[model samples]
Target: EGGVGYCGARRLKGGHLRGGTPAGAGLSYYYDPLPTNCVADWFCLEGNSRHLPPDPLQHPGARPDLNLAVFYHACNFNCLYCQNWSFRKATFSGGKVSAASLAQAAHERTACICFFGGDPTPELPHALATSRLVAAGVGRERRPVRICWETNGAMQEAWLKPLAASSLDTGGIIKFDLKAFSKEIHLALTGVCNSQTLKNFAALAARLEERPDLPFLMASTLMVPGYVDLEEIHGLARLIARLNPNIPYSLLAFYPQFYLRDLPVTSRDFAFKARQVALNAGVKRVHLGNVHLLT
Candidate 1:
């Protein structure tokens, strides 16, 4: 189980285990042998203009290229509408790579490295190690290589503080997918309570005050038809606004996928309405993602 702990309490111990759900006296997290796939989906190497902080959008001429590393076969949540659901059956056998090897992938051209999943929480150790290696300037001069994370925001405080600190130091952003506002509906949609996620978000929001120049924190929600409606959007917006109205929130269009294929793709009107709801709730920066999926 050579992977990072979800709570950052420990590093992945040396072993041949692929992955497993482990818990301590009062702590719970997952451990996985640096799963076979290192980089799942690499995109926007030329720099994704949509990323927050408006650096790329504000200065199109100075766009910083980014590299996304999508880990496989590790997630704590069970969202029926999971677009990357295929990771559940993905085999990491003979596909695992060491932290140093993975870090090598982030060359000088890479301005940022985003660790996403299934969910990075389960593979926190590997991600952390890779981030540290990249930050140390593995091959190039000691230039900054932003370390970012897109996660469900359910990791314990023990692991989160350091992760946030790392991103804060590197000018990277940590994006949390707040599935839903209502606890009941959130459970219904993701098959897990969002209490921990919400708690972690509040904690991270407070941390953002230390580094205002960097868009260190972000939030997003999939506009699932019927499940995540205007009301849900408003509720989530208000929650985020309560902490910091400036916190950018993205309303994502949901496409019929996995176990939720019966549902229609999120409509353009719904996406717009969700944005309006978030704006009306006092959020200053709200936008729509996956617009192509909107009918």
Candidate 2:
């Protein structure tokens, strides 16, 4: 495989859950730009969120200025609602550079770095190495560095452990994307059950051991059509409420994209309605996505 070599979405016996080349859906590994060392750019957005540039009034949050961004590849989950399906399913990239050069790119811009990806947490070893390199890059200068990872809670704690441990010390932001409350719904959309996710989430809480001073947030979208409905939203809200209410869970609106093109577009009303469903179920602070709700 002359590409972003991903093996399988299989669970190892005594090791981490990883993409397997064994059987079944067989790890849909591919690559695209941004998730690479070269040609990647860093925006000076606050806290290093890899957000798209302003377009009209559709920006999610106007407060946090974007900082630096490093694009990574491969995902453990095949969520039907993934907007970056092209990037996830595609393989290869244009830019080719070393981690040193990548650190240089970051240094040239802002202090914060967003490790963007199909899901950055999978390649934890690579991510950790890159982080060390980036840390070393700015260490001498005493430049403030914050690491932020955007991930779906598909991989188990075995896989996420190393990253999570390192993340907090680096002033990292753990943006966990919890797909669904029910394991069935999670399986239906992301091809994996939410059991490990739930377990890992609880594990994270346990790891906190009385406020470990970690910055984290749980994010999720209310995928449309086949993915979720009003009842599912209620279930998810209840799930999150049992965990942590303070964490802002983004209840995003759906749009017809990728395999869901034939489905209806997520209207602004539908988005708010979904948010309301989450709220009604006791989830605090539901943020709408893929819609023009905020102004």
Candidate 3:
């Protein structure tokens, strides 16, 4: 029953609380000041092409560049195959950053700023504040800066709508990493139920329909060899198709990492097969992400 409450003025030591009840029963959520090792990763330049969205790759006219600000460890889930598992070291020890200074990191070449991490939901206040500053051109001389998020999609609904609205206005994208469709398998993979994720995905898809021009929502799933199979992919695809077939679905190749290191890397054959399954399920645009990771 212990959960986070959404009061704008309520401040934690390092972050502010954006209130909402836990998506999972009996789970308690907490806020920490935003801790990050902000770095600009170039891979975002190649946006998701399989899904028709307004990304840097699609809009060449606007500066299609981005600054990937990786937030430090602080997630609601305990995913076993976390590739960026290093965040554990900094989850609580990393230096905290103010919203203003963090927003200032978006330089002239940066057309958009992506907030990702162990997950950004825990630091929603900081992310929201930083996004506001960027949109308002706090330090960038009134230049428009797009806001984007790569999240697990389990945040309270109270936080999700505002974040979605920010992305919609700036021609940005909200990518949800839908781990699994089955509740049991989802809990096994991420130590949480998939119910909130599925619910949130449906909510965002409805929001996308309101904005015909902007590709407001996208979804992805990691193909973790033995854990995530073709059957799971098909089920996920059907769910997405039912919401909106045009919603882009990406099947990512899994690499051995963290507790799942014993598992083999996702094979190219498996990735392609899953893509076909998704396509057959009526998802118009399906992509195989991290192709290079395929063995």
The top-ranked prediction according to lDDT is: 1
What's model 1's lDDT at 283? 95
lDDT of 3 by residue, 120-236 (tens): 787777777777877777443334566778899998888877988888877667889999888989999998998988998998898767766556788889999888999999999
Model 2 lDDT tens row, 134-177: 77766433434667677766565576666665566665556667
List TM-scores for all candidates, in order: 0.79, 0.70, 0.79
What candidate 3 gets wrong by more than 4 Å, as runs, is: 1-64, 138-143
Off by over 4 Å in 2: 1-66, 88-98, 140-143, 207-214, 293-295
Clashes of 2: 21
Worst 10 residues of 1 by lDDT: 23-32
lDDT score, residue 228, model 2? Answer: 76
The number of clashing residue pairs in each candidate reads 4, 21, 3
Query: What lDDT, from 0 to 1, does candidate 3 have?
Result: 0.70
* Number of the candidate with higher TM-score, 2 or 3: 3
